[model samples]
Target: MTVEDPLFATPSSEDIERTMDILGENGVSLVHLQFSDIAGGGRTVSIPTALLPRVFRRGFRFDGSAMSGGMRQVEVDLFLMPDPSTLVVLPPLPDRPRRAFIYCWVTRRGGQPFAGDPRTILQKQLNRASAIGLDYRVGIELEFYLYKGESLATASFESPHVSPSYFSDSDVGTALVRDHIVAWTHELGLGVHGAHHETGPGQQEIDLRHLGGIRIADQLNSTRQLIRVIAEQHNMKVTFMAKPFDDAPGSGMHLFQRLLKLDDGTDLLRGEDGADISAIAGHMIAGQIRHASAMSAILNTTVNSYKRLADGHRAPAWATWARVSESSLLRVPSTPEGTLTDIELRSPDPMANPYLAIAVALGAAVDGIEQKLDPPGAFDENLVHYNEEEFARFGVEQLPQTLGEAITNLTHDDTMREILGHFIVDQLLTVKRAEWDAYRRHVSPWEHIQYGEL
Candidate 1:
């Protein structure tokens, strides 16, 4: 029993109609429409080419039972309204079928956005920025590890240098795989600034160029999917879990952001008066710092993620900012005169739902701008090596040490509940709390080893 609202007009009618002509001419018979579940997991629905016009003009409906993650008390029909702009001629892959697919906006039967939808949630926050004549362009640096073949988190190796700038003869096979991946990335119109080996064994970093609005989040999802397909083709496996191996450096998804004038495309952070630091930029930083801990539950998103956020892991261990410190939660890497964007948020791991992550961040930033919040004095040094005593002396606060802690922080932040709907927030609490409870109940090998001696 589902119905489309009369006002729920299909998006970009002309563009989709035109694209379908090309798709039909190219002999494309199937399309996979993709959307994110509440946790940012990618889900898809395959539609025949014949249904393209109807699906685009109306929407695709599916049972909510499978993908809802228990958010709904009863199974209901959910609609996916495809984003025509994301229609891509997906090149054939060995494992996947030859088809074109588009990302989508999740909606309810009445044509209203589903409250738990990540993309819709993000769009709401961005709309807040848009209302004020502001916009954000985001650049993503995602790190993941390549394992030998079908490996588990327990696997470990002797390691490479704790450096990202070096690549050796040992990187040949991985490099070739990455080369093919990068080529396909370009083919799909997801351009990359760089792809290279990172500090840990078989770790790699791929930097996606800055994109505006929901497009970057959509592309981030596509890129992660692409990485897996490419890895499987080469008989290698990849892990985006923040810390898979205890001994190795944790992987992170560093976000670089800039505020822009929506109409004129001016870099507002540079300021009208051309001050060294704009009030907007300071407030943005202050806003992000204010919300960092609560946002961690969404950005980090896993029990293993906290391990990556630990000290000495080249990840942000504390809620701190610096002009250029790599180890702080927020780092402004450049200035108004510099060639690069100034603000980089370093705490998010690859496990996060990019949509929710960016939404909370942007929401917090918008709050900062609205409140005219002032940032604290900067903590200029690399705090990765700093102990708690040193942190107190410098007045920096540590991020949550565990998933449980992160959940607690999230509960206290009404801003997160307000920004991300209560439906999503409550769903996360239900799921993550269960996970933490299960972890607490389970017995590990360490317990056996220690208690056996006792």
Candidate 2:
């Protein structure tokens, strides 16, 4: 299909006009066209609200070579055409002009969608699912740490107790941050379910209601931005790093997903009995399990992400599925009588580009359905405590231990390679491999303390 086909269609003129009118009514003076780079970093360029109409017509151009992930110096020119459907007014900040934000799709000079663009990569996969009359719905639980300053040395709070202070109501600092985040996210139209203190000191979590794939991705990006902005207003810094401290609990972007019938919105994953999973759910879980190892490279994009996947940290270290165990790579959360059911992927972190992460995941699920793949039987018991012999008997496999190993797995996994496409994969590997190499060559305090005198 063409780039402007139903899958990635540009917003209609009427839709753009309506959005412009809404922005005008909201007192928005600047319009920010936002996009995500390959490393999940947010990028933006702002224009006066009056210029948005011209942007919609001609598309904004930039030098992609300046960015980290997608383009090289030789082919530097890239265009960002804002998707007007994503337009939303930013929450007002004191002493700042009211602004609006719209996500953009990366295209070439001639307006063809850039294959290496993370959003386009996701849209392509969404189109694949749409072609089959299915819709992918996703909910994300984002975990992050709030600190007094940008570095650990300047951290404001430190707990002396060995036990975690999960859900504690006493930390007024963190509570205020959470309150602002919830308020701002709601103002931005993200359906905020709840926010609370996590296991680690100064750590927090926010859960957003499930929505369609693209919408959820957009909201996720917006959520991160708002969280950072709100925290800065309070003179605190927030980090979504998978593991910022070696001894503390790591952050994760736990993704809950399900499929629905396009025509009637019937949940395809629901079985006859509420307690049991349907056949389609099984196949999708099987697909996720089959590709879990390779998927880790993208889901856990940073080197520190591997540190969170250890045995006792609640992060899954094995490629296993279970109905209720949080220790498994995939878990089926218990649903109330009338609530929606979905699968939770525990491997992802906030460092991942949400667009690419969800795209590959849905692609795998669709492949599983198409192939009628059967996932391994559920391992209800905690696999972390299982001996190697028991794990072997159950055919459970370990996830890659390091970023290098994960990249190696990604290189060999044909299914994942096909889903993300060779171009995106090549670009990702090039960027990530360089990061791995730099990390390998760096000298750390631990290394110096261990070897300097010895």
Candidate 3:
């Protein structure tokens, strides 16, 4: 029983011993073996701390059929082998039992990797990049909303205006939540750049410093869980829904990505002039733009996701790139002298599986570089406000307008299907199509009000 992927390198006996020592010293009573499903949902199976040594050697087995995404009842047995590097001790919060968490690699009973596992899918993509002498760094700007409960109408913190309330000190609730998140993130060893209030009422954003692809994905997943736990502690509810309210701005999980050379840690996207973007960067952006429509399926991932892409919400709705406009799908920020340059992809919501979303994205960029695709001219203006003639003149086109449309694009695109294998793509399409069908059949209040009387 051997598994040999650089991303899933088996933990050495010494390394496992050291981690066990830390858990024992911290009085950790439970260990959470966590993994993500194909639909971006987190699933976990907890084990008593006494089984740590057995887990390190043989791994824990679970029923895969009970989980969302792939395995059926006939092929249900799967194993979770913990990754030692991802171990994080729970903060000593009052009334909460001491526990440690670690992410795991999904494998079959015989120790072969599970292709249907979202984390494994991501690692395969990373392996492809590594084979080419390249690696990637990712930073996330995650926006979410705090509400009283299931009611979207009641914000936890009330504000009247829609103007950008970047960091107003007047809201005590927001301040407390933000501070707690920052502190807890720091305690968990996930570097936090900052947190602040966003434009929508009760909306907030957290910026994480850049890290390697796998590490950042793990942190983002953990951060989402932690936010929910902290929100409950304060007797509030937090949602990463793309568009929680029709009239308010949508929350987005904006991704900042940069590619680097594996050998010397040099940024491959930085131009020699220090002021211009490198050719490789252009190709990457071009790749993103070319595949923007298909990529939306994974990036946005929900029926409600389309609601956030309305004309005036600051979300990017078109497949275009720009030098600095927030309205563009890809925004290339001005690189300060001697600083690294990166691209910001604005379509993803927090609902997506960070692992799969980033893997597909980087895979597309690699495709563009290999084919040497040239990008269109950068659109430096607000695309949402563009007229038909202007849009045609700029060669800009709107992204897929609905979940169905996005799925169609995803199914038809050979590149995306290749990056995410036929099996994974088939499973995703099946799940999303069912979701779309269910939504289509349901009648909403808006529909009832508009046409039910007729």
Candidate 4:
């Protein structure tokens, strides 16, 4: 099956052979084929070096029933087509010098892209961007929490081991880990823009240079995988859990997105003259606002995600856009000239699939542009302070307060079904419903405390 050369142009067979030769020369013993499930966890299958060639040509088979949301039971043959461009040596598992990791594309029996695959969904959205004669570029700022692995037993998260400082002189106790993160990120060919301690203790942020379309998603997935793997090797446990500790700040995967027109390198997002952004940008923002409730399921894809949406945390409460307001859902950074003016979405947690998150953001923006939707005025004041009257005046609506609520909104939105395929939408709801149902059945410490002996 011949697929278009858009998000991923299948490389020539020679390219694949060349990559294999390099890996062989480097003494890579085992090839770990990796793919992402719907929930963004790394799924892997290891095959011997001897079978690498056959695996590359014919692809390898796996039990679809076992993987999450990617496949269903009843003998559906799934293929793992390795992308040669994603080959990188696993730093954490250096002992297996011959073991390398490569990202795989999930395909069905007749060589069709799996509709439920988040990676493929993002690619489809990028293809949509191409059809509109615009290129979607995304830069990512990834935040994570670092904790002492053994301290989980009895550690007071109220007081962190480190303080918030963008570039303070004091070293965070996890400086070594942060430095290691930088080194490995560079080694893996990601353009490391910067890394520093965030406003919260034990929380660190790493920014990657902007890349066009699917590369942004690829970098995010690979970077997260590398970050966790490296942290584990250092005898520490790292979490991207949105709100891992109650008193601590939540970790967010902020995506900075911009649209560039293909013709003459003109940015469709901003106007040519020295003024406000072009009409396309306005419409895109409008589309995002129109579908805020629906998009929440993808952005905040976990039960714990709602914890960040409440006041005090940086999570966006309203679907407003602003060049100055950081509290807005779509924050336009006011950087100096020549720098890209991008939209910063604060809703996404590090736990969600980066590809799906980006896809949903872009897809909603595309809808707005297509419909020429008008965005409301900027909310300069803190949305948390808005009273019922003020909120009603400004058309401010609160984000989904829980996973179940988000899913309910998503289920009714036709735009979500159009952007994310029906299959994917169904799969996401199915998995998340199971999660919510399981969570409801569990007895919690809070429950016990609330009515222990009333």
Candidate 5:
């Protein structure tokens, strides 16, 4: 079914009226119709109040090729249909008034869902789960670093701690930015489970409640945007960079995934009779571990991402699963019997695209179910000791060590390339290669200091 005509029941007339009332009450001057490109970057075109109804009924059309990795030049004309349920009063800038934001899905001219669209990719994964009589529930854990001021350059790594504990008084600059982020996140209708000051001086994390992938992905993208906006308001800066500062911990995009079967709405990962996990749960983890090497390019894409992949930085240098270990690539959380049991993919960095991240993860899990794969033995000791020989024996392989190697792995893996499609794969390679070329030419302080006098 098309996104506009969801197989599920539509929102009631009363709900529509209430949404209109809310929009009017909020004094929203314009509506920002937003959708994600294939790279999971936000792209939008604003419409004034007078044009919203007409556009809402007929939807809006634009050239699909203009969107990065969306479509080829020959096949253009993408359509956008907004979700009324997603209407929210957008947080305004210093000089701007309130505006509403509605998430949209892209489609072809005849109203078919665009295959190259990242959102559609995720929707297909969700639909596939439905076909198997399973429902997927996801929760995202967002980690980010807060910087001193609104600038591209990072603070020196040697700086002392300027931020306090979550509840304690922080330095003036950090406290002001954190408060703004927390307040605006709540104001934007995000169900922020909690916000806290991380261990590092300028690091922070916000936990979000469990929700479906569609909305949660939207929230993830918007949350990143919110951090920057709110930080700017306080004259500070925020980064989702995986490894911005050389010596500090990097940000991660951790997802908790659970499956519920439609037959009787039972959590598939839980066992009713015993303490052991369900067979299906074991298989799912197995799939993730099996595909972990191929999936690394998507999970940890940026050049700096590998900087955080070293031992002791909380980056999973090894491909392993665990029931309770937070350091594993896939963590199966321990929960009470009869409650939802989930496996968390912990390798994704904050810089990864939310839609692509979710798509790869869900696709891997679904593969697990279809193949009936069983997870390998779990590890209690640290995984960093596994060298190439040991990793091969354990069926574990080190992730790509550099962006160049990552691109090669991603391009060569037929499964990942087939799943992601050529458009996305090619575009990602082109973009990242350019970034590498630019970075390779740079003479950084590390290089200068190490070689200048010697």
Candidate 6:
């Protein structure tokens, strides 16, 4: 069967031969078949290099029943179909085995696409956009923190540096390690616009140039792996957690999205005469806002993720759109050319599954267009600063304050349920509800300090 993905091209026999040759030249003895699990964690199946021929022809079988994120009903075997176009030789790291990585597609028995596969779920959404003669393009700003790995045992996130600086001095301990990361990112063909020190010590941000279709999701997964590998090489560690420290600014994966006409290469969100809000742009924004609460379950999955939403350090609390408010869920970012065509969503954390996150956003915008949804007017004033009386007048509402609340909102949103698929949704509800319950029952240090005295 033909792959429906916009970026997938069937690999020729010659392509397969060349990939094997390059692996030998790079001194690689293992091949890593990579795919993302439902919780956005990267899963890999490693095998010896001698088995490429059998892998290409018959595919490698694994027990999917044991691997699923608690959503399985029966034991079934799944196969990994490799994408040859993503071939790259990973750079050498300390005490690490050299391996060539190939991103794979999960298929059920007889080579049918697995409904629960994260990559398959995203591809379906891309096809939907293509059917309407439009393409979804996304640029992501990924934020993460670097820590001295040994300090993790103490429960204090110890950074290599001591202060918050926008751009750290070149002599910082993690500076050289950061350079190695950027070099390898370019080696993998994921173009880097730039990297810099963020507001918190040891926190760094990397921005990639935007791409269309499933490539963006693929890029995010690959990039995260590279970051972890490089950090381990230096005997350090990195985290993409949404809220790792209560005193520090949380790491968020901000999404900058645009829609383009499939045939003519025209940007559909392009505003007339540099106006902030275009007709279709307005509708897309409205549609996303209409489903914002439900979409939060996909964008911010963890219980700790909701802490950042309380918003004193540049995160959103209200589901409002604006030109420059950091506390608004969506912002119209200013560009060098003064074009406000792209929509910037600030809520998604680095921990989110890029496949599901992008799919939900694109699907919601498409719904907006089909339903002619009208978004409320954009506000310039900060949303977190608003009083309850002011919020009611603008028809504004707060986002889900906790994971349980967000999961409840998701169950009520039929549009998001349809977009994310019932199988995925069912698994998420069961998994997340349990997570919420676990967190509620666990006692904390603050709880002991307050109630123990009484």
Candidate 1 structure quality by residue, lDDT tens digits, 67-136: 5556455437778888788877777655555688789887787567788789888888887899999988
lDDT, candidate 2, at 218: 93
Model 3 has an lDDT value of: 0.85
Model 4 vs. true fold: TM? 0.93
Weakest 10 consecutive residues, lDDT, candidate 2? 155-164
Off by over 4 Å in 5: 1-18, 69-71, 91-94, 150-176, 385-388, 437-445
What does the lDDT read for residue 123 in candidate 6? 83
Q: State the lDDT of candidate 3 residue by residue for 1-454, as single tens digits.
A: 4456555877888988999999999999989998988888898898898897788778788888645655666558888888889998988778767988999898887677877778888888888888888888889999998767556665645433434466766666767888999999998888788999887777899998899888899999888889998988888889999998877889999899988998988888877765467898888988988999999999989999998987477888888888878988999888776777788999898988898899889989998888888889888877756876788787877888899999999998999988888767888999999999999999999999999989
Error of 1 at 22 (Å): 3.0
Least lDDT summed over 10 consecutive residues: which range in candidate 5? Answer: 1-10
* Cα RMSDs, all models: 2.9, 2.1, 1.9, 2.5, 3.2, 2.4
**Which residue pairs in candidate 2 collide?**
none
lDDT of 4 by residue, 379-400 (tens): 7666667776887787777778
Residue 205 displacement (Å), model 2: 0.4
How far residue 265's Cα lies from its native spot in candidate 6, in Å, is 1.4
lDDT of 3 at 284: 91
Model 1's TM-score against the true structure? 0.92
Q: What is the RMSD of candidate 6?
A: 2.4
Residue 98's C-alpha lDDT in candidate 3? 93
Regions of model 1 farther than 4 Å from truth = 1-9, 94-96, 153-169, 271-276, 335-340
Clashing pairs in 5: none
User: In candidate 4, which residue pairs get closer than 3 Å at backbone N, Cα or C atoms, i.e. clash?
Assistant: 28-98, 29-98
Model 6 residue 197 CA deviation in Å: 0.6
The models' CA-based lDDT, in order, is 0.81, 0.86, 0.85, 0.78, 0.75, 0.81
Score candidate 1 by lDDT.
Answer: 0.81
Per-residue lDDT over 268-339 for candidate 5, one digit per residue giving the tens place of the 0 to 100 score = 888657745788888888887777777877788777888877636767877788776666888877887557
Task: Give stretches of model 6 more than 4 Å off.
Answer: 1-10, 71-75, 94-96, 151-162, 338-340
How many Å off is the CA of 322 in candidate 4?
A: 1.5
